[model samples]
Target: MAQRLQSISAVTVSGALVIVLLLTLTFGTLGAVAFRADSLSGLSTRDWAAVRFTVVQAFLSALLSVILAIPVARALARRQFWGRSVLVTLLGAPFILPVIVAVLGLLSVFGRNGLLSQALGFAGLEPVSIYGAHGVVLAHVFFNLPLATRLILQGWLAIPAERFRLAASLGFGARDILRHLEWPMLLAVVPGAFMVIFLICTTSFAVALALGGGPKATTIELAIYQAFRFDFNLSKAALLALAQFGLCAIAAVISLWVSIPAGQGAGLDRVVARRDGSRILDFTVLLLVTLFLITPLGVIAVKGLGSVLSLPASTYGAAGRSVCVALASALLTIALTLPLALLAQRVSKLIEGVGYLSIAASPLVIGTGLFILVYRWADPVVLALPITILVNAAMSLPFALRAIAPALAEVERDYGRLSDSLGLTGMARMRLVILPRLRRPLGFGAGLAAALSMGDLGVIALFADPDSATLPLAMYRLMTAYRMDDAHGAALLLLSLSLLLFWVFDRGGRVNADI
Candidate 1:
């Protein structure tokens, strides 16, 4: 009994540590940045403009992403043609894809000299420019559309076959089906999906940096970066960071109230046999979505092959560093997530909310805070990689927790008494009972964290000196230098590494996850 009590205490303490770490890294950094803000000047016109642009873009991005995703997700759920599984799997790529790489891909598709422009030029039309607020919204849609599709698709798949059958037998038309079956699922899932994507777009830094920076285009996070990096105006940066935090906090609060719906009333594990939609429409929706998402990737692969053989050693070194950081971040995420997951509900709800705040918090804001906190005692450059790892892990915490926490809870609920009666506690219980059951989510969450960290360009860009640059940062520098060939090659490499890291961990988890 004493040993079991000690084990439980240790788990509780570790969970508390995870909460403390999240608080210190998130709000603690925000607080440090706050102290440096110039209260007298407040936000300039440019600052307020950035703030408005940020909110508008995020709202538009989320709205459009969810709206477009409905048809695509419905098409996917209804159709099971060849390569369907592959198509579904690929939908997840944009989530882990490097932001710099994604920007490059977007440029290749929609830039003034890109395919769209070329087609227009062939028709003797003017070239369309992708360099402002519209471009930012477009890029965000590219990233979030797939996410929205997957979420809504999951909802569609959860609709029991009986529901569709019953509707069909009752002579339900498309309108009738939408009213009875689809509307409920969309109502339950779409709000959560929109809020999640909204929060994501609100904290965007790299997308705005690459495609939007004019008076009407700059986001709050981008403004913070400009103040810190170009102007060397720490006060302005701090103030902008505070604004960004307020925006995210508001969005997070809204998201909290908008809970992602749980699985609807379960059916006898059956595939939904959807029949209301037209085959032509379904096929067209699938094809358009595939082309939109895949063309950029195809361009990357083709363009990258020509220059990958000649990439500079510096790029390789940066890649190596990114890999190291990714691995470290993955391990740290797993460690922190496990304890936090194990101790869920036993810990304070406020602490859990703090852990999730990382989702809404800007990585740039966190990095800036860290620089401020560390500058008083240590070299920020020297701590760049470490801070990147810590921040990346924190940035990934909400997703990991969402994935792993429920699974851990389910395992503990099912086996708690069994383990206790068998005298299995501490390492023995974790290893023999909890872990085997948790392999799927653990591996998946770890993979997600690793891939995200590998492709992370946010915090590293803030703190990295030349020597400490990650591949995404180095790739961005190359792009800025007009080294298109090298940038494309580096992007391909980063994409491959991100995908591979995710695959390895995800596959490892599923290999024997039938427990």
Candidate 2:
């Protein structure tokens, strides 16, 4: 009876936290709406244009990312070589890589003075510019392609070796193998990957701000930033935020509907000898994909080596602020995620839908709303850092839940009854039976939250006073000032800090951890 009461208490606490998050979002959005009730007149022509451009770019980015990922994922799945595991791990890098860093790296490879343009100029050919709509698409593809590839690769890996063996026993050639086995898997996986990437691209702020050369290429997110930061038009910002919220929510709903879990069940590690895919073709694909992903990162490292130590003192100050925010966010996220995950083991469907609300939310909307709420009571700038930390933690909850929930459920499934029978309730049970087994996922989730928070530039950009800029925002300011070298240095610092935080947390979790 005591153990049951403890379980109920856990569930109740988790449910209350979820309710608080939902209420915060709901009331904040509604409050912004009320504040702008008169200004909620129809969207201007420019607003419509922003909406149109946003959807089109997200669609194009998602389509191109998934289509390109297919070949790369297939090649990786079939080819066995030295450093395969390393390559797979490298794919996760883009997830935590700061957007500004990626944009700079990409510019080094595709900008007017870049290698491609220089080679073309040497050959008496016209230099190509990487700006406008195509530039935005290129950046999105760079970031999302690896994500799509990993998702598709997970699908491929999930296919049982026994199935492959059966197909081979029937003398299935390359064409037959693709037609019979691979096509079906793609059918199940691609749409979900496309939708997920599309939703992500919809909320893109940093990439669009940098690569989108002008109004012609501007995304809705950039428009929101302009409304809030440059124009100081809270009404217009709120309106745009609502529009963005609607767009992402619709996409999120569709994604939830069409999404088949890609990497769910385990597969045998045995390699199935397959009579498919040309060795030459696989090698070419692998080489191009590797170059595409690796060159920009290499440029960042090489270019920053000369100037990384010469960054302005303000850069280090911003880095310190960012570290504090990231650490706080990570700790908060883990605290929120643990109970939510534990509760999710009992009410998965409901908890999952609620968790996705964060993804559908616009950071600008939340910031605008909070600014309205707190400005009435106190100066918004005073609460800026705390609000940023809370918002970052909220933004990270879904991912943290994804990392931790499954492990919690698995533990409960495997060991719940044993603990209950032993009368192990409350803190003792958690420390003795639950936490020791949860180290790996907890560590990974915390690391991910920290890295993401460290690099995030959304809410903070709206709230930060001059003295309160975070690292990413500091880098943006340097770029805007045309201090390219300083910007590179800041990027290097931000990148190193983000990766180091992730490595330390992840390694900590894995030490003496059970698989």
| Top lDDT model | 1
Listed in order, each prediction's TM-score against the native is 0.95, 0.95
Candidate 2 residue lDDT tens string, 315-334: 99999999999999999888
lDDT of 1 at 317: 97
Residue 51 displacement (Å), model 1: 0.2
Error of 2 at 251 (Å): 0.4
Q: What's the lDDT for all of these models?
A: 0.89, 0.84
Q: For candidate 1, lDDT tens digit of each residue in 169-279?
A: 999998898887889889989998999899999988889988999899999988988888888788888999988888898888887688657455767877656678799
lDDT of 1 at 122: 98
